[model samples]
Target: MKSITRYLVINISIWALLAALSAGVILTSLFRTSAEDAFDGQLDMVLKMLVGELATQLFSSEELSRPGSLGQPRFELPLSGWYWTVSRSNKDELVFASLSLGGENLTVESQSEKQYTGGIGRYLMGKGPDGKRIRILEREISFGPDQSYYFRVTGNAAELDEQIRSFENRAWLLMVLFGVVLLTASLLLVRTALRPLTKLQRRVRDVAIGKSEAIVGSYPVEVDGLVEEANILISSNKETLERARTQLGNLAHALKTPLSVITNEVRSSDLQNADMLVQQVDVMRDQIQLYLDRARFAARHNTIGTVTKADPVLKKLTGVMSKIHPEKMVDYECSADSDICFRGEEQDLEEMIGNLVDNACKWASSRVVVSLTEGLEEAAVKRPQKKNANVRKWLSIIVEDDGPGISEGKIDEALKRGKRLDESKPGSGLGLSIVTEIANLYQGTFSLERASLGGLRAELVLPAIKEE
Candidate 1:
């Protein structure tokens, strides 16, 4: 998937998870509240039943002075899980109290109607009993006129806590399952939505690998734009390839026609002048063919992956010059902060630098200095015109000669194809032209100016190639 669409899927999935978790927590809390209220209601009914039975038994009893009667539970059936204590007061004093003992005794401060029924509410608290923490549910119970008789009921809160804990655990488990289901559903949705894009990708790959000429399927509107762009690029590249091929074919055909004419003319000439004339014609043919070959080399593929390293070029050139002209001195200097490179064909880079260095060697009296720096100057040369900030990361090579330089106004024409300043100089003018084209393809710059050493200085500024 494209970056934006992938992010959208991930973001939606995350929000869905958070929402699911929030809902799970709220629902779990609500379930626990409902369960607690139902359990509390049951507990209140049990307490009310016990209070009613105890009031009836106490009013009919003839053993009111006995402590055993006070300790006896009135209703045994409803008090299955309940604990209780009863106390009697005479003249605002505890005249009688129950013998049931456990954690703490509930104290009654006053006689009021509020103490008779649901006087005090239950709350959670922990009490230390026998060096152990005991969670208890406590409430005060009052009976009879003047509310002098009081009862306190306490129950273990462990069962209620367990119920809440179990509910929370189950809720979390369900939430996790829901989240997984939601994530799986989201991924399926993303996949189904991107199926058309995947088909487009496969078609484009087929075209790239030369398995097909173009995209081969109907696509969605969202994907139509990308398909159209791909088709345009492929068409443009094919046109360029065809044009280059045609130009080469025409150049060959033109040269062959001239060769055929020369052969015919040689056969018609007298034997005396035939050999010299044929030799001259052969030389012309060779020169024409050489220029054509250079032209083909100059028509480089713009997307060719080539990286030019200055140090390697300098090393190769210096090594060659040291072997060929051992008696002559050559010095290589570089002021570049780092290695300067360019994204162009390696053969083209070799030819460009080789031509400049070879020309420098011919003109240098004793020393030929090659310097590499990285920076931009104002655009002067028209062939490889500089444009874009990306070109500023350029490799500028300055080849200086100590010997006499080119005459004024000749440097401009030297770069033009087949324009040689000196006929006596044993070289084709195709070198600079090839270099200019290579630089132009990468949007680099080239210039020929007078060196401070009173000799010709050739400057080649090419865009830097970033190392992977």
Candidate 2:
């Protein structure tokens, strides 16, 4: 149930963290190798200088009791962790030592028996005097067949470690900053990349809420296919519903005439079962009409982009009502804002409003009033957290009459199918029931109360479409 953006961010963060960790480790290892190689190169240069100084001493015939300087001043400081020594290779006897050695010997443990040859030396890590770690380079030079000397130079390993540690700290800091910058850039890129999808989501929501008939917008190639598929689905659903409604209407029309014939035939006969047959045929006819009305209402329910102007439909219905019941001599008054509209099919509005007006004329003695208003209900405005909060603008149809109103306790029965308060009244008792069904299909409500004119007040509330 997680959003796409959140899922992408989580995955990207995990990968970025792992990439940072891997880069840090690799960089640390490379820096360590580079630092050790630099330290070893310094040791090699110092060892070569010492060997050359010893050759100079031998050529000048100087005594080997004291070590000669190799031009590095730190080698002269006692226990300064930089030292040089010369010894007999065969006996391991010290021939000369630097002052920094403090009269102690440097002992190196060799892992292999092979000696470095070809005028080159071997570098070793070993223990110095005072148990300090040191890097040593040892080389052997032969003055004659029986004379061989070992030249050894040592430097503190701690200095090399400190250099590597300092580089590690700065390198890791830079890598962390780089990772943060990359992740931030990635977040912005994701939002920008998915903006089309967000817009598409809004368009689809507009279709669901009856604001638009289809998804409409420009999209990236990656999402254009999805938009097309959604439009196709909407079209498919509408087509299927239309086909079902057509079939239901055809079936209703096909059955009505035959049923009417059966009822007429039974009424004309005098057989004992004629009455039973007539009653059964009449029930069948009512059921067919009821289901046909339901099929029509279902077709309108949830239909997108269906807007009906209320003023014209109401005005037309009032004119028809006067002609339909001229004997009653009922005076009709209708008032509505021209901009007030219903968010449903025109036929559905006509059906519901026509039934209410007809029912009012049937019961009214002299006067009937039909009014339309556009506003949010008191309960709807107070409880803004309701599911249909977007449908705040409601079109209210109020019909009132001055004839006798039904008792408040029997109002519920009036809405039920085939429930008639007086059998003397000329009706099938399905008028209010059909109105209620149609109102419910449009996600509206139908209610009855005491009219201001002393008859019944029939109020219908339906979602309204704004003029714009």
Highest-lDDT candidate: 2
- For residue 284, model 2's alpha carbon misses the true position, in angstroms, by 1.9
* Candidate 2, 1-468: lDDT as tens digits: 359899889888998888888999999999998887777677678887877777777878787546456788889888877888888886368888888898998868653243333365677777788888888878888776666888888889888888989999998998899789879988999999999989998898677656788999999999999999989988987887789788987898799788888888889888899988888888888887887878878876766656788899999999999999999999999999898778878888898899899999999999999999887545334533332555657887899999899999999999999999989888888889988888777667778889889999998888886675
Give the 10-residue window scoring lowest on summed lDDT in candidate 2: 378-387
Which clashing pairs does model 2 show?
none
Candidate 1 has a TM-score of 0.48
Q: For candidate 1, lDDT tens digit of each residue in 171-289?
A: 89989888888888888888888889878877865653345787878888888888888787777766775688688879899789988898788879787889888878877876777
Estimate the overall C-alpha local distance difference test score of candidate 1. 0.63
Q: Which regions of candidate 2 fall more than 4 Å away from where they truly are?
A: 59-61, 65-67, 90-92, 107-121, 239-254, 290-294, 301-468
- Each prediction's TM-score versus the true structure: 0.48, 0.64
Evaluate model 2: give its lDDT: 0.83
Number of clashes recorded per candidate: 0, 0
Q: lDDT at 356 for candidate 1?
A: 79
